[model samples]
Target: MTALTQNRHSPCIGICKLDESTGFCLGCGRSGDEIGAWASLDEAGKDAIWQLIPERLQALSVRVRLLPYAGGELLDWVGETIREGRGTWVAGAPGAVAEFPCHDRDATVTRGEDELTAAMPKARFRLKGSEKLRAFAFDGDGPVVLGLPKRRVALPMAEVVTPLGPDEAAIDPEFRDHELFDIGVARRASRFCVRTGDAELIAALRAAEGRHWTELMAKTGATIIEKSPHRVVETGLARIEVFAEIPPPGGTSPTGPHTHLLAEFLTTGEEIPAALGLPEYAAPIAIFYPGTPPA
Candidate 1:
């Protein structure tokens, strides 16, 4: 099938206003380059970016309040708050619908339009028309509405809270390396869920905490179920301690403190991607890992 024939629909809304402070278009939640390069990109690239939009929108649309309790990582604390505040929703393919509560068996869940179903366990349902299959859940108390297209994707996820802001945004290079970019991938996907109001599917994300991204991938088998609430730290800006290496002695002999060189570029005075050695149109996160570990 042609590329256009196989994929879902385009996500652009045509508003096209770029937000300079965040480097994302206020309308579509995409970078200028992404908007310009949309036609040239393959379906895979489009899908990847489509997945990232919701997270960006979530960060921009939602209000993040720092939890008062201090201890452990902030993301972990946020995760705990989520688990305490909401119920758990698990996402998985049952191989056959028989494994789950069918419409005939459970009146609460009846199949809706275009293979969409409603009232499943924990208020979760499956979504169709994508290259991959997916599902979602929501807090029973709030309006059971899903957000999309217009920018607002969904309500506050019961189990995950994304702390969004320039000060709260940033990447922990150490943690990123530990997950090997898998968490990075999952973070975007989780944001998509949060934006789209897929609570049950997001609830499934709780399982990935404290585990390596590879392990989570193995456990889920590429079903698009991995999740982590911590990626906001990687996405937004925060006080990141950029360490630098001490140069060798003037005599051309290596210094005793020389382990490795780690350099980070930052200008507290302004927010510009170019200062960080990135294209003017690139995402602020495009230059996230610039240098090595400090000596």
Candidate 2:
């Protein structure tokens, strides 16, 4: 039988240490009980456990290892790492495409004295110095090294101005009178897009977007609707509802579309925002602007 037809088995990667807090095996994300019962578990039970592993692994903290390479050695090590299938490569910049299961042919690394740059499709890294290079590993999927400047500064989130135009306003002359409509409007005008108080989820969304937004959505099994000016992305973890081509509150024209993220919980198929007991419009924890550098 081919690899695709082969039966599934254990996920152990040999680094079988258990996390104290979560009681899960660090390498395979299986609970101690799960591991002990794995051999006797039925196929359906195994499948159920496998379905939960991704979210469990995502919940764990990422582990980073600082390699000992310096100067020109950094460049050589990067090439060798990719060739050896160490991990996927992620460009340091926001909105940069990540190279998952990166192959040597799909990556190019070049160096000049103390600086280096690695280029992959739709992703590029420009490093001012190689002294501070490090590798990031997430859920054992990486030792992925990134080229970044020695000193980096955090940029503030840019303001998104979406004035309600006449056409949009005409949709509902009494929209302001409706609380739900006002909530949606306020969300669009707010600096942040994601509406959640969960710090962990916020951090995960930020890190995931920083590495690769599309990849994160795909990994989470998100359902995406790519219709212009009105796109929606819904996943088990979060939901993003976007409204684009908005104009000024009283204006008549439409402008380019912008995006925002909305977070809510679901059970079966029903939304349960009240489960968190958060206001209809909680303070945004994270905002995402596709094709634009994260703010």
Candidate 3:
């Protein structure tokens, strides 16, 4: 019932997610900081994770599967959608799409079978008589994200990438069973923290904002800049946001970090890197090139 529910045990299930400032997922049963601090927690400290589980499970009631598709299907993307090939999300745009790894390589959220494809650019995808979709590029055991590997322990694997779209919250009313893995969700700026300071770094960010933003999101206009307490890797002159949802290209604006863009990453966590150095202002971070630049 409360944090004191000892005998029955809290629903933590071993995954302890701390607040990002701490490198833990109060949700996933891991600290936002995965480095030294988490490694240092003793059993007693670890057992307290038992207390947070119930609160998190209550939140999972809204989890949905992130299904990947080669072309736009009857499905609507409730969270985010990645366009893999060169074509646009128009009538028939196909290269490879699986609700999961469709985004740029660095932005992969989960492992899926890339089973579908569009025959040509602007070729609307057809679920029937279409190319296959597999989550990974390789025939077997495709790619795995380096930092956060898919939890070795498998939970229920629901079939989301099938004919039906992710069940809408309005229609399904009951969705406690399906939960899209919130991998890197914390790294999102709105979902986590973003630090700013240092004239050059800030200026560079502002400049980026002024540029690609319009191209990233569908609409145009700048969003306010905000600073927060969670500091990921702050050394002398720089800190960083680990993840972000860059807007799509050519919606509005001058082209740069769109004010409405969602940026998420780690800060003030136990896993903070020591070899950290300031990010070079010379170019955009990985978010800029979610896929290979048009060459």
Candidate 4:
């Protein structure tokens, strides 16, 4: 059956604010340069950036949750009938403290929580086991908000924390079902541009050499830098390729021209055909890394 598809668009939220510390936008998780040049990039570039947003947001959310609580005060308004009793106090810097109401001229003076603890050097809010203070009120003061506000939108914990692993082709064969993985695979499968500049290696890879040349090259100290499956129309076939950059070994600074290390799968099409028996679930057509060519 003939297929019909519509054009794909970008994932820009427009609420762009670059966080200096993380170098990611608070809303879109894109670098400032990426945001500025979004319109000019091809589909591949846009897809690459889009696939990273969810992972970035998950990391940022975790970081925000673990930040120290800023110090707050207990005002005079929170007190009931005057009674000399101890109460718990919290802050990011200072540990927990036992605070007793000091009734002198019907006035209350606020001090850093750290002052009560000899070990603590700065004022901070701390909580004990199964204890959380959503809001704290002073005897004569307004309620001060504490800790990170609850996340309005819930994120899937599994997707947020779980990684796809080093080799996408072998990591989890079933990951495509996941939204994050699906988007990531779509990006890789759809990308048309490659980062490598070696034309010789590119031509060799395009030719589909019959023999597993990467294994023969590996004995010479070559290594695999990156490897992934290139879908049809992206790399011309459903192929798992090992991308490597080989620089001349010994006293060489990679300043001169070099060959790219590549290993193509034995089979072709939308899925890896099981007919070819190979180790590590892949057949190495060519292999190269940061070293001189073998023999």
Candidate 5:
């Protein structure tokens, strides 16, 4: 059969509900008119409509039922799909659907519904138990789609908070601790460091090597002092000397001095220490010498 013939099939994945705001079906991302006229439409017409489904899905808000599976169940499903070389794995519940492409040999999915919870080998998904809850995944190196279950009434697009870029991040002193500093003599001299015990961030840094590491560090608004054998960044206030260093066997970071390259900081330009308003004493900082201040 020709590719075009195969393309004639419907895109529906069983869930059938219209997003009132956009008048698009959540399952197939098709309008009522499009769905009704699908049979009458020519191949060209169908092609045109198919072209719009992705955009419609991106814009429309649809709700789906949650899969009542434990963390292990979900993880097992993901692992099986990957092992079987399934091009895509999809799960649906009532009015919702979640789908992802599975091809990586080393993708890892852990149990957690928190943001930046882990390195997320390829993609990270978080789910909370609530009828009105929406499960989403990190847009790392893969694509993830979740048809969130929301109230019957969907909010206007204008009300949604669009993410800001690194350049557009608001200047807030609250993120002061996230700042990097330069301090040390000899081998550590002129190096910058940001202390953090966040295992997720550490893992991400370790995974992002070479150009990926460089690009990730650039988001910190830090000056690139070095970028070859090891990456060194300067945030005017401090320097990152030990970026991407893994912790010891117990997962505890070194006591003296180290660097952190958190994915949250790279993507959102927000520092956890600053957002939590942690005190200087409790902040993630590793001074070279006791009582010695950062440069």
Candidate 6:
């Protein structure tokens, strides 16, 4: 029973040629190439270039964009604590597991700034067969930087969006705390569901949402998003877009303010393991990568 480790084949397609005008790569799906070509292109061309690109795509890859804290908090779930009842996903467990410490089925281990800063270089060590990194940044596939056990895990989650400021957005509590992390662990265990379609899946998400809300209401004895209408929109003939402004598993107020890692799932009456590049709801340990919260 081993824990999850790095993929030897990083989603790195070594295409580094930048398209100066588009800031994107004809080689890779990046956006830094076109800045140099800007003067030569029409304003319309520049407008059409990056309608949907995230401001940070130029600095992201499948490895880093999706999972940035590969070294720092990446191994937060992988450790002897799997047996210590500490975090959630215990390292060597086989076949659909949850984070190591259940912690009452509704609590989270805090990886607050102090913890992260202290665990610094040690957390940066790479796992067996994985390459090490120097100075982990949000741009590249951050440091593998740790001796990790290889195992597939999943998480369960529900997102609650909040306003950070006039422009910036971030997850509440500033980051994914323990409860949120468990969703990932739950995903792999058939213990979680993150579906977007199908009456049953929708019902499940609603149930998860309800459970979360009810727990919060019970704890804080306050009402939040309880009045917001949770519904679906017809995005396509057979596909409907479902959305809700629920809160994070931890509580009502977010840490700073920003969007969370919410996504749309398409169900064809079959088990979908993914939502676009995002992992399906049943992911054991969500690989969350919080960025510089909007200021």
TM-score of each: 0.25, 0.28, 0.15, 0.20, 0.24, 0.22
Writing each residue's lDDT as its tens digit, candidate 3 over 144-249 gives 1111112321222211111111213211134222221111211211111123233433343334332332231222223212221111211111112221233334
Give one digit per residue, the lDDT tens place, for model 4 in 1-295.
1121122243333445777788888656778888889888876676677667666756655211111112121112112111221222211101101111122213232223321111111111112111121221111121122221123212222201112222233212442332111111111112111222334433333342232333323431232123222111111111121122323444232222222222232113212112211123111111111122111
Clashing pairs in 2: 164-248, 164-249
Pitting candidate 2 against candidate 5, the one with the higher lDDT is: 2
Q: What TM-score does candidate 1 get on C-alpha atoms?
A: 0.25
Candidate 1 clashes: the total is 8
Model 2: lowest-lDDT 10 consecutive positions: 178-187
Question: lDDT score, residue 268, model 4?
Answer: 32
CA RMSD of all predictions: 22.6, 19.3, 21.4, 28.3, 19.5, 17.9
Query: Which candidate model has the greater TM-score, 2 or 3?
Result: 2
Ranking by TM-score: 2, 1, 5, 6, 4, 3
Model 5 whole-model lDDT (C-alpha atoms) = 0.33
For model 6 the TM-score comes to 0.22
Off by over 4 Å in 5: 1-7, 62-295
Stretches of model 4 off by over 4 angstroms after superposition: 1-7, 62-295
Per-residue alpha-carbon lDDT of model 6 for 1-295, expressed as tens digits?
A: 2233333112223445655555555333445545456456664554444333334454434332322223433435333222233322211112221111222223233344222111111011112112221111234532211212213322222222111111111122221121111122212222221222234433333344434423433543222234322121100000111123446556452231112222122112212122212222211212112222111
Off by over 4 Å in 2: 1-65, 83-86, 92-101, 119-125, 136-151, 154-295
lDDT winner: 2
lDDT of 2: 0.36
Go through the candidates in order and give each one's C-alpha lDDT: 0.29, 0.36, 0.23, 0.27, 0.33, 0.26
Taking all chains together, the TM-score of candidate 4 against the true structure is 0.20
- Which scores higher on lDDT, 2 or 6? 2
